[model samples]
Target: MVSVLTKIFGLTNIEIAEDIVHDVLLKALESWKLKGVPENPSAWLMAAAKNKTLDFLRHKKQEEKYARQITPLLQSEYTIGHTLNNYFSENEIKDDQLRMMFVCCHDSINEESQIALILKTLCGFSVSEIAKAFLTNDSTINKRLYRAKEKLRELEIKFEIPVPSEIEKRIDQVLKALYLLFNEGYSSTEGESFIREELAAEALRLCLILSQHTAGNIPKTLALLALMYFHGARFNARIDDEGNILLLKEQNRKLWDNEMIQEGIILLNMASTGDLVSTYHIEAAIAYEHCIAKSYNDTNWKNLLNYYQVLITLTKSPVAELNSAIVISEIDGPDAALNVIFKIELADELKNYYLLPATKGDLYFRKSDMIKAKYFYDIAETLTSSPFEKKLLRKKSNMCT
Candidate 1:
């Protein structure tokens, strides 16, 4: 709704579009309280927004001259209804949201600002929510948003999908932004809850939208969706009734969503069409290994290690290396895995990364070095801000006592 309205008002008047949306929502709250939600609530809201926008344009006259472009079409009530009906049509709304996402990823804006803009505009995230997402203050987020909106005005970027030639690069940015959003939800930091399922679901929803488009339904898109589905299948099993974290080995496989797992397998198969192998493809393969395993002990550590090796070759991500070391611990011994961990050159980056110390704690615990395990777990507890993670680390630390 915001996307369609913003397109009509021009990018320069985004706040006006936002204000209209806010007012429409307020009206809905007030009216619904007395009269109850209408049968077709969506259509009702669209009509209300359309009426408010028309009234604003008419009242402002020369002030909002940008609406002058559609003034003739909106001259009569009949014509105005016809024009707005087309704009708010189901197909047009989807296209508008997709285009808006591309505009947020314009090269003129920095990636951080692009993400902030996307969270704000597309995901309907508040500045405070965005600040918490980035582990920064609201003022910092506001500044990023200010700079991003100014960049949009300066560049005059259109609210349209990129050309075919530019689709791959621009879509990569879109994927990255969505991936980060999903990760934040999957392993949320300290917030209202440990897992922000809505944020992750929103990311998955946007990815599905992209996969439906001609330029976006590529191999990489399928792979990313497959990866997401594989992870989402276990969402229910990730937490106990009390919302404590569950280790992979501890999760009940019966609680996993088999339907999502099957869908992920199908998508993973479809993602194999192109010669382009992405980190998503490798990650999906690793997740597939876990999904098919009867038990944690039955997991194909060799295959997982092979996938992680390929992933490291492609991306050289520290997280991948850390995971690869874990796989080594399962196949080889704790000593070998510990040696591999010690040899990892990017120790500086991993120093405060809770996973590293957590992995070390697990490895030491497996080796029956309880004192060392407790020490590493203590460090892991301090490094992590997540209440869920802290609880799990404390559980491990207590085992050493």
Candidate 2:
């Protein structure tokens, strides 16, 4: 709704569009409480939006302030109704959404603002929810959003997708934001719940939209979507009824969504058509290996290790190296894994990361070094804010007693 309204009002008047949408929603709430929701709630809302838009244009048409590109059409009595009807059509709504995605991810705004804008405008996340997702205060999020809106207004960014030649560059920025949003849900950094399923679902939803668009139906986009599906398939098995964190090996394989897994495989194959091999491609392939494994013990560790090696070489991420070290422990021994962990050149960069010490604790436990295991586990427990992670670390520490 915001996207379509933005298209009508122009990017410079985004706040006007947002305010109108909010008013429409508020009216819905008040009316629904008295009269009950209409049978076709979606159509009802669309109709309400259309009526509100007509009212606004009729009142403001003389000012000639909205949608500069189509201001003349909007001012004319005959063209105004038809023009709006076209913009509010189903196909136009979808196109507006895609255009809005690109507009939110424009290079003028910083990355943080881009993500916040995407969540707010595209995903319907409230400011407080976005703050919670990022472990920040509402004031900070508000400021980020304020700055982003100002930038968009100052630049007069158009609500349209880039041309084919420029689409690839802009698409990467959009994908990166979506990837972070998904990760925040898959492994929440600071929250009571270990998983923020809504966030992940929203990210997947937006990515699916991107996949359907001509400008965004590229290999990298498909690969990211595949990765999301593979991860989403495991959501049901990732935690127990009590909400304690469950390691991959401890999860019930039966609970995994085979349908989602198959969908991921199909998308991954589609993503493999192009010559480009993005980090998303490697990550999705790694995830595919896990999905196909009948059991933890049956997992093809050798394949994962190779993928991680390529991932490390391609990205040079210490986190990837740490993960590769864990795979080494599976194939070689705990000692070998420990050696790799200790020798990591960027190990200091992970000093505050709970997983670094937690992985070490696991390696020590496997070596039957109880004192060292307990020490690392205690450190890991202190580093993470998530209650689920802290509980899991404490459980590991108890085993060393």
Candidate 3:
């Protein structure tokens, strides 16, 4: 809706388009209450929006620049040959939508504002949720959004789908935002849950859209898609029937989506044809190795460690170091893992990050240091946000005690 409206009326009228869409939503909410809900609610909403836009344009012919764009588009778009169904075809709308996304993520906007606009406009994120994701105040986020849209209006940038030459450069920004969103969803830094599948689901959907486009099969793109699918395939098994957290080893692998895994593997193979390697490329490779292991015990720990090394080399993060500690415990022993952990005393970043303590607990537990393990587990329980993760930590704490 935003895509079509923005294309027709221009970015200056985005607020007007939003108002029309919001009005239709209000009507739907009211109508659904009385008329018992329409069979094709989306189609009904689109029709209402089209009518409203036409009406609005009719009244303000002289005042609107979109008055000119709407005539030809409306004629061609609304004709019997074209139809609403053709307008809304997944590929057609999506192609325009992604071009809009690239324009939204333009370098002119600061990274914070770019992300905010993309979330609110493209991804349908609420202001409050996006504010929460960044651990910032709502007013601050709102200001950024306001400033961003104002810039777009002032610049008069046409929403466009880029040509083949520009797709890779533009898509990098889009992919970055998607990754950040997926990470927030995958393992929320602020949320109580270890993972919020909703955020991950949206990211996966956007990435799938990216994958299906002409640029989709690019090696890096395929690798990222493969990585997301592999991780997504495990969502169901990661939690128990009651939604309690389940450790990877304890998870029922049978519940993992075999189709997604196979697809991921195929994409990974495709990605290997290219020489350029990104942090995501390395991380995805590591994830692929884990997915290939038939069981936890059957995992090629040595090869897994090698991938981790590659990941750390490409992107040396504290979290990567902590992750390597776990692999060391698996391959060599707790003594080896403890040496790795003790060498790094990261400051306040891990204060609220549950995985830090959770990893510590695992190493201590393996070393027969029950006292230290219990303390770490207790800390992990406090650090964790998800109901599932907290419960899992408490379970570990009880066993440790």
Candidate 4:
């Protein structure tokens, strides 16, 4: 809704569009509470939004500024309804959303700001939710959003898909933001719940939309979508009835979504058609290894380690190195994994990352070094804000006693 309205209002008047959306939603809440939800709730909302937009445009036709390209059409009565009807059409709304994705990921904005804008405008993430996702405060998120909007306005960023020549580069930026969004949902940093299924689902939905478009139907896009499906397929078995985190070794393979796994496999095969081997391809391969295994012990750790090594080389991410160390432990020994962890520790790249200490604790526990394991578990507990993680770390610490 915001995207469609932004197309009509222009980037400079984004707040106006936002206000209109909020009002429409508030009105829905009130009406629904009194009269019950309409049979076609989605159509109802879209109709309400269209009516509100028309009312706003008609009232401010002569005074308020709108998109320069369509200003004259909006001002004239005969063209106003037709123009709006065209924008509100199903195909145009989808196009507006895709355009909004590109606009949020404009090269002029920094990556962080791009992501913040995407979360707020495109994904319907609240300021507080975005703050929690970023492990920051609402004030900081607000500032990032403010600056991002100002940049969009100053540059007069068009709400249109990039041309063919620039589409790949622009799509890369959007993919990066979506990747982070999915990760946050898959292993959320917020509250007690480790998974925010809705956020991850939203990311996947947007990725699917991108995949349907000619400009975004590239190998990298398909690879990322495949990765998401592989990960999402495990959601049911990732936690216990008590809402505690379940390690892969403890999860029930029977609970996994086989249908989703099949979809991921299909997408992965499609992704492999092109010569470009993105980091997502490697990551998805690693995930696919785990999905195909009958049990944790049956996993092909060597294959996963190879994929992780490739992933680490491509991205040089400390997180990937840490994950690769875990795979090494499965193939080699705890001591081997510890050696890699020690090297990562020396670099101090993951100094404040709770997972670093958490991984160390797990390694020491496997070695039966209770004292060191407990020590690392204690540090890991202190570093993480998630109550679930803290509880799990404490559980490990108690085992040491």
Backbone clash numbers for all candidates listed = 0, 0, 3, 0
Q: Which sequence of candidate numbers ranks them by lDDT, best first?
A: 2, 4, 1, 3
Candidate 2, residues 1-401, lDDT tens digits: the string is 88998888888787878877878888999999999999998888888888898888888876745545446787788898899898889988888889988998899999889888988888767788888888889999999999999998898787889999899899998899889888888877365343368889988998999999888999999999999999999987998998877899999999999999999999999999968899999999999999999999999999999999999999988999999999999999999999889888356678798999899999999999999999999999999988888999999999997
Per-residue CA lDDT of model 4 for 1-401, tens digit only, reads 88998988888889988898889989999999999999999789889999999999888866734545346887788898888889899988888889999999898998889878887887767788877777789999999999999999899888899999989788998999889878878977464243278778888988998988888889899999999999999986888887888999999999999999999999999999868899989988988999999999999998898899889889888888999999999999999998988777755678799999999999999999999999999999999888888888999999997
Native-referenced Cα lDDT, model 4: 0.88
Query: Which candidate leads in TM-score?
Result: 2
| TM-score (C-alpha, index-matched) for candidate 1 | 0.94
Better structure of 1 and 4 per lDDT: 4
**What would the per-residue lDDT of candidate 3 be over residues 26-115, giving only the tens digit for each residue?**
888998999988999877877787677666765665554666655454544346235434555566678767766777778778777987
* TM-score of every prediction relative to native: 0.94, 0.96, 0.85, 0.94
Error of 2 at 84 (Å): 1.3
Q: Which 10 consecutive positions of candidate 2 have the poorest summed lDDT?
A: 187-196
True lDDT of residue 261, candidate 3 = 90
Between candidates 3 and 4, the lDDT winner: 4
Report the C-alpha displacement of residue 154, candidate 4, in angstroms: 1.3
Q: For this target, which candidate reaches the highest lDDT against the unseen true structure?
A: 2
